[model samples]
Target chain A: MRNPRTGWLLLSPTLIILLIFGFAPFLYVLFVGFNQWNVFSADDGLVFNGLDNFRRLVFDDDFLHSVGLTARFAIFAIGSEIILGFVLAQMLTRNFPGKSLFRIIHTLPLMVAPIAVGAIWRLLVIPGFGPVPFFLDRWFDLKYQIGSYPDQALWTSVIMDVWHWTPFVTLTMLAGLSAIPKEPVEQAKVDGASRFQVFWYVTLPFLRPVLLTTVFIRIMDAIRTVDEVWMLAGGGPGTRFTGIYIWRVVFPRTDYGYGSSISLITLYLTIVLCWLLFIAISGRRKGEVE
Target chain B: MKKRFTFILVIAIALLANMSLVSADMHGWWAEAAAPYAGATIRGVSESTPPSNYVADVLAAQFTELTGINVEFETTSWDQMYSKAINDMEANTGIYDFVYIEQDIIYSYLAQDYLVNLTQFAADNPDLAYEGYDESAFTSFADYFKNADGDLFGVPMEAFVKVYLYRKDLFEDADIMAAFEEEYGYPLAPAENFDQYRDNAMFFTAYGENMDMDLWGTTVQGSTGHPASTYEFLESIGPSFGLYNWGINLDAGSAMSANGGALDGDTAVEALTFWLSMLPFAPPEATSSTWDEVASSFAAGRAAQGWVYGENAAWIATDESRSAVTGNVGVRLPVTAPGVIEAAEMGDGYIGYYDGGAFGVPHSSRNKEATLLWLQFIGQSSVQAEWAAAGARITHTATFDDPLIAEQDAKVDGYYTLLEEQGPLFAGAPPFPFHAQVREVIDPFIQRAILGELSPADALSQAAAAVDEELSRLGYGM
Candidate 1:
């Protein structure tokens, strides 16, 4: 291990960053959750309301609804990204004409900044005037206007996120695919394993670690995303999602104390959930060797 | 492990070093910013998220030229600015020398003494005093800027009113006019009534459908954030219930004006409901659109009508933009209720007014003298005239009154005429504490009604409950 002391020292920066950004802010938020002070108010003037804000968040119907909505959005968005990304990676792995160009074209989305992507999608999908409206009209011959339904805004947000982030999943999976040895697959085939069996058993097992890692990273990014939601719906046609809800409270209202509390709560939830997923996935594969 | 450790270490060191550079580059003076104010890197912030803030290069350069004070004007979207401002201010880090305090935010800032009171500063500086600034010139627009006790805490930063704009050639054309008048039982002479305005707007928009042109009758910014263009529909319906009216005195003395003239429950409710009913006619994605979105939509000729603001009048109406109908854009008066007073009974009135107050020195200013000098330079007729001609609309009559400014182009004249003619219907900022929170409820509810999520009555009722809650929280009248 090259001396535990030196090894620890070498890894100290990451540990320190994790402690400060990861843990400290999480702890501060719990402390802040009890107070009624906002950012505009004096920090000393923070009133210890003894979970009054949390009581509001936990008990309020809208707060609980958004929690449900967030869980639903995360599940759908992350799951879609993974499946679509894997499919895209699989397709690109095969030899084909214009394979390089296809790979580059798919990654173009990942290259664009999240905000720029959000802005472009907003322009394209605008209910009446945008290309999305045109595309819908041409495809279905029936108008799919964003005006009639409020909840459609939430769905549109999901589609935009899928478009901008699936490529990230593809890249991660492609890297995993490259790390697998061709000999293992050939041996499986020689043993009379079907092509589907070779992929389902041999190829898939090797890619398990990568899949788990990608899902973990993707879940974190998807939860924190707000740009597309902000640009597209403004948390409307009704305030339902956590990301937009946080932004709306902070800016025009300047409710820092409450806003910070919500942010901290989200961060804590994310960390705990991520930890649980890691342990669960790692537990399932404990007996297996690399 | 060594390679992994080194790789992580390199990224960490670079990130920390970069953060330090950003920190060093940032004006941390906001923490202890109470210096003599000169020879200091003063951090100033504003959330002018529109056609104006894009011209920050001009504002920063002019500010430096006028005061010899080099300002580090940090621009962020509204949320970040609010978050950073509040965080920095609470920390007492002299981070910001100047901050944009909307009229509504004054109450909280004043309650906590986060902002300095401006009464004493204006008194101390004779040249920058309110006397020379023409109080009568601002009378019709002054109520919204004052606190409950009549103290002016924050002056207007920037403001522009909404005007009903339509296609002139289309409105004058015989086919469209005949159908509108035929169906609505009224001649559409610039839409003196809401019935006429919507009916006329719809007529021109529907005519395009009939003409097989890719056009709609009218479009207004339907965004949840400030739906100023939607006010045309609101005011159109407002007059039906006495929800729209302001004092129009020939003399500026005793000169009274309503706070959007919304003082009572019925008027407030009526205004709220009447305002929302017009949203359905707007573009489908109006909920996300802000001022710029609305301007582009109108200019593209895809939309035949929009409630135009002076801020974009110069740009949207110009030929360089390839707007659907640039020169053909005709400015019309804001329409009122059906029977109160038609164009037949009374001529023109201020339909929807937004107060944009300029800078005044605060009692807590580190250098009140220097701040007032900056204020005077901004208020100076010559400078104001130049800014007006350049497209940053000031509230002062003199800026638009100047021949230099008014003659710059038809937009300048249009801006001048709108200010002069619409002075009667002016509504200053709603003098409320937590200006933002109050808006959070009102703006959303108004949009809900327009998008048909809530009926006009339901939206108003929900909004009333929300506003009442905010008012109670802010220690307003119980």
Candidate 2:
């Protein structure tokens, strides 16, 4: 904090790593978007094809469908996660018996890797071997088949996401809730302010920034989710999100130029979405202050 | 007496020296040829299938011990194996010395010149060639990996057909057979035609329901999300209905009947419809099942019959630890439409897919010579019998006669016998350099059809048109 030179030198390693691994690939991908490069057909090399890839993306129904599907998925998954997370966070803020144990148990799903979560859910839902189907059939007399039914597959993915990331949202919200000042709440209670009125006026405003940040992070993560969904469904009928679709194009099809163009478009869409979300939330907060 | 003893000792010494020379001729070639690359480590990547696992765990270790050249083989999921290998080769990274070239994808690899010409490599390095490893020893399956000029690109590691598997116990049951005969008005047996197959599926499904048994009539590899579903419909189901070469006429470069392709023909629609009809008789998991899961479903006794990849037949039939229906499993050729078998016999069409893969040295490989030796090591006749037993695959004709394979054949209900006798009826994927590109475009339509988002007839019509557009984009049939 004292000397600029020392600070610069200390930060150089991290900067170099970010430059080499992060920025370089991003730049390369951007460059690749303007060319016609089939990774398998290397003999042709990277031929500059101008806006052809972009033009192709416009007409590419699969890419468009994937983008729309990803948007819908992010909305459902992040919305559920945020609401559940906030409620859990509020409950955890209170003094309760075995609070530490409860917190640990509630947060366990957050520790599971995305790929492992997909594998676990896949095992749980697969008809014969999975217990979920067995229990559903036994208890409700309903035949639960995620593999055959697209609706079931899509909702199962949503549920899996909620199960996996709600804990992370809860943890973040819990931290924010703990940091909220207690003096105002106590004053409101002495003045005979109702619990709901006091909480809405005081706690909500305090947690606004934390809520926005959590929503932003979860939105980005949910949009880019591939591993869990792919493992569970292989981007099958209902769960072919943008991440899996892009992977299919780039890896299986090996159409680097088209894949790159689609990726760049997705990136722009994600940025715009986050920006709109930020503006709306921040504008609301500013209006309240006014 | 002393002179005679000395003469006899001298003769004995000469005979011992000659025997040592013969011994050196038989086995010393590997070490002597591999001397230059002793400390060099050659890396390979393959799908984590049984054959590839054997190569990774058993053959690699044995090869290292014999030649002193370290073998580092990485076996991963099917998708990762391909992406990793392709990325390395395309980037010219020299990361993998060899990669698995599946029979279906060899055309693409060859078209890109991504693989080293193994036949030429051996000719160029005569001393490095293993005497026992002759290309001629391989079965007809090896021909799939050859180029137009008759040069081999890959060494065949595994080869098998997709065969129809049935539950022998159910088929042989006195009550079940009587019930089946009464309903279908025919002797209850393995299906010999499409109608019989359908009837069997319906009967068994109802029979299970009536008897309060947990069973389905068939396993449908109809996953709406994965390529396995496309493979099932196109390779297994379509071909059984007499639609060959994915119903695409490569010569005309079209998938539409209007353009001379059979993709949207009545036969293809009939095939798709029949396959969809079986979905009700298949277990709930059938819609989500890949080839792996189909094998599992059969092994778990969830399906009475199914079209299963032969590579899984051995384990599902004999490995009691994994298979509940081990002893009750039976193998036979898939039921074909009328005239389909004749066409296959005449070598004009195929009944089903003959699926397999070979390990080939990449052009980008830094250790081609060393990798070549490793390939030859696995391709040797002496290794075929055990490899065949382990993987349920046979690349060499001689493997069928091997005592180990013969023993395995009986255990798997003479699967090897059927393979040897009927393999000619099955064919590898058509030699299309645009295989993946075409498959990608057509896959979604098949998926849509399976999920009932599109009718089978409509799906094929749209898919055929899409394939035409794609093929045209790729500059085919211009």
Candidate 3:
């Protein structure tokens, strides 16, 4: 007594919505990517430029540099966030006075907007005047213009990203830790295993999926990071991330065709990275479903 | 009979007086013409500057009261304003009725036909033109937004020159002067050349160090991460060194002198090199500073001299709460190298950047007539005086002589006198349809030079090559 018409009707709304919201724009962008389409001077229909737009990307030094910078930023920011987030999550899991207060305090940074965090850090790290430079100079004898020097500016952005996003990873890790069964860990402890050994042998294996998921999410986010870096150094001091670079190409240059082509490249790169991570995660446990 | 005649005379006089008051009414005419478009709400976007904020918060409401046409003016940062306005127009969304057309970008807008021809629109609907609206009242600044054929494209809203602001207190100090003269073998005064400027910067910086105070010789807008850094170099610093029209040679249509342009010529290289050399003498904040921060540094007495935008000229001199050196600030035309002024006067170059923007009706706007009325309302000569004083920007020729501005001239150490006398020396950005594209190609290289990633000569050479390549790709110099 199944009505095929009814089934089709039920799915039609979502199908239409997706076509309009997601598929249409994607297809239009694909069409634009193959042409010399300047939106401002778009009088005659898009001129067919074949792969010329994509070819331009190969020779664009700024674009290539941005892609490289984004990778470096991603590796530094996410790698640090994962390790630090896990440690903080573990510290919070232990029984202690004011544990809830500490948990709340630790998550405070996540509530703030990324751009605001960047601005606050910009103020803090300003040399000769900012509190950060003052304290670091007095306490550690470290004196440098943090946001003005090319090397230091990149590292400063990484630090701000970690400060703003580490809380998300920690909260996710804490949830996973709470859900893990205590039996294996307790048994290991009773068998005279040290704290580190018990955690490594019993707790870590169980937490593998959660760790992979959090890292994957963080990596994806780090690849597309823009706001904080924009507010802080504005992709300057030689720290032009992929996001800011693409923004400049599209808005300032107004070369929608070439910008779309570049954007498609980034999209494909992210997809490939995510696919590899997925495969690695699945292979870690032979029978586990991701 | 005599009492009856007197009563009639009194009534007649009262009626006539009321009639005369109505005749002189400014908004009464607007109210009559706007009857058809009353209650129509027009949205506009502009950078969040003093004049824009004033128009949004004060003038827009008054306009509504007079014309019954509501204006929803959204003031935002330059990037966001450009993005929103351009996107809306590109998409033909009719989301915005008016947009800010900066003098630099008008050429691009004109090329794209994104704006409605103001002159044509005015002619098409003569009924919509307000009584106070007179296109002739505007100064030559309006020419920046007009086509070669003399068709008006936008209504000039704000105009100002970027001038050099110095700490008069520091320059006048007897001890500092004697020390400077003893070291440099010249009287310590406002610099007239690059050499003098450099000596002053070095001398004051050393003086500050000796005194053990948190002060610097100059404020350099050297934020390598933002467009402000690039703008400062190209507009303020480069012009003084004789790099006019962005060093592009009109005859050869190239940026490289070998190809017959001056973009990478000796003067341009020296200009950028000198600009970067100020890093050591500037406040540490210079590396992350924009025009606003530079003004703040000068106003707070942290720096002895800096290039400050005219929009900030008034507040830095008049507003005590915000400006620490309110009473001791001096303003003058930026010092230039030898032959620079004469060359500029002879139409070979420009001395400084004449920065400003205008309001134009977007073609995608649903209520073009309503938007046109709003532009006219603001463009009226009577409104120019108050807006000029508030924003430190003047578009009308008569605004230079406004009593309020004249009064403010005395407060800011004759900043207005310099503006009135030397204003003709500066000019707006060259009318290039590829302005944004060329700037984008040049900005990063300039930023790299400031960050010490490239030598001045290498940066300029590379930038010139990139710009040449881009121009070719866009069919400019092919």
- Among all windows of 10 consecutive residues in model 2 chain B, the one with the lowest summed lDDT is B469-478
TM-score of each model's B chain? 0.71, 0.94, 0.93
RMSD of 2: 3.7
Relative to the unseen true structure, what is the C-alpha lDDT of residue B127 in candidate 1, on a scale of 0 to 100?
46
Q: Assign candidate 2 its CAPRI class.
A: medium
**CA shift at B313, candidate 1, in angstroms?**
3.2
Alpha carbon deviation, residue B92, candidate 2 (Å): 1.4
User: A10 in model 1: Cα distance from truth in Å?
Assistant: 4.3
User: For candidate 1, what is the DockQ?
Assistant: 0.18
lDDT of 1 by residue, B341-405 (tens): 34323634333545354343333345555555444434434345556655546546556567765
Give the per-residue lDDT digits (tens) of candidate 3, residues A1-290: 28999998999999999999999999988989999876544242478899998999998888899989899999999989989998999999898999989889889999998889988987888775689877886799776675467878888888889998999999988988998998888889889999889777677778888988888788878887878888777777547898888888888888888889988888888889988988876786665434
Using DockQ as the measure, the top candidate is: 2
Task: Give the per-residue Cα lDDT of candidate 3 at B463.
Answer: 87
Reference contacts preserved by each model: 0.34, 0.49, 0.55
Candidate 3, residue B95: lDDT: 94
TM-score of 1: 0.79
The pairs that clash in candidate 3 are: none
What value does the lDDT take at residue B378 in candidate 3?
Answer: 92
Q: Compared with the true structure, what per-residue lDDT tens digits does model 2 show for residues A55-168? A: 998998888888877777888889999899999999997889999998899899988999999999999998778999999999999888886787788889999999999999
**What ranking emerges by DockQ with the best candidate at the front?**
2, 3, 1
